[model samples]
Target: MKKGIVQVLCGEGRGKSACALGLAVKAAGSNKNIVVIQFLKGKNEETEIGRRLEPEIKVFSFEKSERPYCELSDEEKQEEAVNMRNGVNFAKKVLSTRDCDVLILDEILGLLDYGIIEPSDIQKLMEARDEDVDIIMTGIVFPEELNGCVDKISRIDTVDIKGV
Candidate 1:
């Protein structure tokens, strides 16, 4: 049985999401479907660049506030938790339905770090996808518990916060 490669791009680096989006663009150029579900980030405003992706690469962010999930007040965090879970449910739906050729769960690692979801959720998410559907996850921290399940793990730690 064949299965799609699961890749994780993680660490304190800045380009993780960019790398995922670049891959999505490549997939889109090849006439393939791509879906991006962004978490942790709370940017409610959609940029012009994001809008340009169009029906080719669908980007979804369920966050309400412009503040990061970690920055929210206790009450706000509670509210965003529900929204984030909805995003996870939507991701599961996309995977089960084979709605896209590539699924990019941006900042999903942070979801684990924040306890919004468990390794079991990730395991289940992985199980839910079709064999040929690639999954790319980007975040600052990659949980060690999932090390063996994924096909590839790219640690994207930054060398320096200041330019050399």
Candidate 2:
């Protein structure tokens, strides 16, 4: 099996998640198994790509509350933290098992930024990932610690088109 490298996608652009989803579709088209773990997003099957790609692609979300992290009460924050921790554990298990060819950690950077998960947690996930499983992470800012570890880092910037 060919070795798969880690890829990070981040920036102020609007299509980070969309790009990840597109890749999931492409991978599915090639019969590659995919697992997407979304952070900070509530469960909504109607808008979920994983739901549409069921049986081929699996998605798990760590969102326990619909409220924004910044606006959450201390108690709610604590609860969300637990859910995020569980999500991290699940991700570690998936990576270790190597059950899928592709793994997408959607909005994981936001989790780090919001203190939902620690930077060390991400490091652990990267270290535990199987050699054959490609990993994709999408968020607004790339973690500095992962700069040297990831194989490719793509930053998307929005272009203002006043009139099109």
Largest lDDT belongs to which candidate? 1
Score each candidate by Cα lDDT. Answer: 0.88, 0.84
Per-residue CA lDDT of model 2 for 48-149, tens digit only, reads 646777888898887667665567788988888788788889999998988789999988899888887778888899999888789999999987887876
Clashing pairs in 1: none
Q: Model 1, poorest ten-residue lDDT window?
A: 43-52
**Would you give me the overall lDDT of model 1?**
0.88
Off by over 4 Å in 2: 45-49
**TM per model?**
0.92, 0.91
Predicted model with the maximum TM-score: 1
Worst 10 residues of 2 by lDDT: 41-50
Every model: Cα RMSD to truth: 2.0, 1.8
- Residue 45, model 1: lDDT of 53
